[model samples]
Target: MFETELTRTLNIRHPIFQAPMAGGPTTPDLVAAVSNAGGIGNLGAGYLTPEQLRGAIQKIRELTDQPFGVNLFVPEQPEVSEQTEEAVAQMTEYLNKYRDKLGIVQNPSIKKFSESFEEQVQVLLEEKIPVFSFTFGIPSLDVIHAMQQQGTVVIGTATTVEEANHLEAAGVNAIVAQGCEAGGHRGTFLKSVSESLIGTMALVPQIVDHVSVPVIASGGIMDGRGLVASLALGAAAVQMGTAFLACPESGAHETYKQKILASNEDSTEITLAYSGKAARGIRTAFMNDMQQYPGEIPAYPIQNALTRDIRQAAAKANDSQYMSLWAGQGVRLANDQSAAAIVKQTIDQAYTLVQNRFR
Candidate 1:
C-alpha cells in the first residue's frame, strides 16, 4: 500500500528499485524477479553491446510482464591531451607487473573500449522498455526527448546537488542521488570524484530540494531502516545495489559473495585504481598496491578494459585479492535470499516500522 511519486510515475506497486550492478552481477533473472515482485528491477547494460543489450531486454520480457528498467553508461570520452602518452605508458608499466605475476605471456591490448551508446539508446527505443536509466553523465536533451517520445521513463544518476540540477534540467523523469557511499562508479561529471563526496544524509535532501523531479536516494542504503530514513529525507524510492549482491539470483561469483558477508562498515573504500573513476568496493591487496599509481591511470572504459584479464584470472583462481569486489558501506547487512524474498521483506519491514512510529 506504500505509494510515492516513483511508484506512481513508473506504475509499479512499491517504491524500491534494484540498482543496476554492471560487470557480471546483474542477471536477467534478478531484474525480472524484482519487477515481478512489484518493485522495478534494472538491468545493468553499461558493459553490454547493443546486440547483447537487446537480447537481455527480450529475455526480461520473457521472464516478466511487469515494469522493469535498462541502464546504459552516458559515454564520456576522456580528454587525451599532452599527458595522454605518458599516462598510457605509466598505466601499461603498472599492468605489466600483474601480467608477469599471473604468468601471462601475451597481454591483449584493449581493442574496443566501450559499446556504442547511441546504438544502445536506439535499442532501448526500439524495445519500448518501460523505464531507462543512465549514469556517469546526463544524456543530451535530444536523446532524452526521443526516448520520452517513445514512452520511456528516463532516470539519471547524480552524485552532488549540482549534478542533480543538471539532470533535472536535462529532463530526466527522475534523478538518482548517488551518495558518496554508493558502490560502483560515482556518477559525477560536474566535479572531480574527490570533491563530489557527499553522504546520503547530506546529499538526498539537497538534491530533493534542488530538483523538481522525483529523487531516488542511492548508496549505503540497506534494509528497512535505510528505506524509511531515505523517505524521511524526501526520497521517493531507494535504489539498492549491495543489498541485492548476496541474493541467490545475483550473478556475483561465490568468492565475491563471501566477501560481502564478511565485510564490516569500514571494510569498503573509494578508489580510482580499478576503473580510473571513484567507486566504492571492499579493499583488496590489488587496490592497496595500485593506490600509488592512481594519477597515471586512464579514465573509465579504457582502465576498465585494461584490467579485465587480471580480474578474470583472479576470479578463476579464487583469489579475492586481485578481484574487484564492488560493494557499498553496508555489506555486512547483506543476507542470502532470493531477489523476490528481499523485496518482499524490505516492503513488509519498512511499512510495519513506519506505521509503528508515525501512524
Candidate 2:
C-alpha cells in the first residue's frame, strides 16, 4: 500500500518523511530510527559547518543502512541597504540586554552571515547522499546536475506555486509544498510573505495541478488522518515536524518536548523576532516583547545568527520563554512515543484508512 511513486523513487517503504527539524531536534538516533521504520529520515544540516555536516552524515550512515536524507538552508547572500542597517542596529541593541542577562562579560560581535554553501554541497556530492533537499532558495542547475549525475535525488522547498515552477524548471526531483502552518522558517523567497501564506490543503493541490514533479505536502500534518487527507489532496507524501518533536529519539530540549506535549492549537504563533524570519513557534515572552521591532529586524541568516546565543543559554537554563520553540499548528496532537512507533502508527493507520475507504 505504501508503494507510491515517492516511496519507490526514494526506495523507502513508506511515504512519511520526518521533517528535518533544524538545530537541536534531528539527532542521529531520531533520523536513523525513522528510516529504520521504513520511512524517510532527515538530518537538519542547515546550520552545520562543512565538517560538522560531514560528521553528522557519517553518524547517520553508521546508525542505519536504510535510506535517509539531509536538508540544507540555502545561504542568503547579505545585501547592504538602509533597512539592513537600521535592523542590525536595533537587533544588536535588543540582543545586548540578553547578553547582559546571560552574564557574558564582553559583547562578542555576532558571527558574520556568509556561509560556505558550496563547501556543503561538495560534501553532499562526495558523501553521495541518497536524497539531498534544500530550503530557503533553489540551488543552481549545475549544482543540481552534478548531484543528479551521481544518482542523488535533489528536492527543493516551495511556499508558492511560482517557487514550485522555478524549482521544477531548475530540475528538482520533487517539491515540498510548505504551507503557512508549517513550523520553523517559511521557505518564501520570491513573493512578499503575505502573498505566500497559503494553507496546506489549498497549497498542495494547486502545486500538484501545476507541476509535473511529485509534490510532498508539509505543514500542520500530524497523524494518520492528516496523512490520508494530504494524499487525497494529491500529495505524494507528508513531511511532518511538530509531531516528531515529541518523539523520544529527538534531540530537542526536555523542556521543548514537554511544551510540545502540553501545547494546544492556539499556543503556537508566527513571529519574526526569533530569527528575523516569519517562523511559527511556541509564543514566548521574547516573541511578544520583540513583536514591536519588526521594522528593526534584519533578514534571515543574520537574524537567525543573532538569536543563537540567547536560545542556547535559555535552553541550558531551562528558560523556555526565550528559546526558539519552533512548532507546527497541530502541536496539540503530539504524543510521547519513539520515532519508530510514530512512523509505524502513522503509516499503519493511514494505510488502513485508505484501504477501508476503497473496500
Candidate 2, backbone clash total: 0
TM-score of each: 0.96, 0.96
lDDT of 2 by residue, 158-209 (tens): 9999999999999999999999999998999899888999999999999999
18, model 2: CA deviation in Å? 0.4
* Model 1 worst lDDT run, 10 consecutive residues: 78-87
Model 2 poorest ten-residue lDDT run: 105-114
Residues 1-359 of candidate 1 have per-residue lDDT tens digits of 67997899889998999999988788999999999999999999998988999999999999999999999999887544576657766787778888778766445766677788889988999999999999989788998999899899999999888888888888889999998888888898999888899999999999998789999999988888899999999999999999999888899999999999899989999887777777899999999999777566788777877788888888988889989999998888899799989999999999899889888
| Candidate that scores best on TM-score | 1
Model 2, C-alpha of 332: deviation from truth (Å): 0.5
TM-score of 1: 0.96
Global local distance difference test of model 2:
0.88
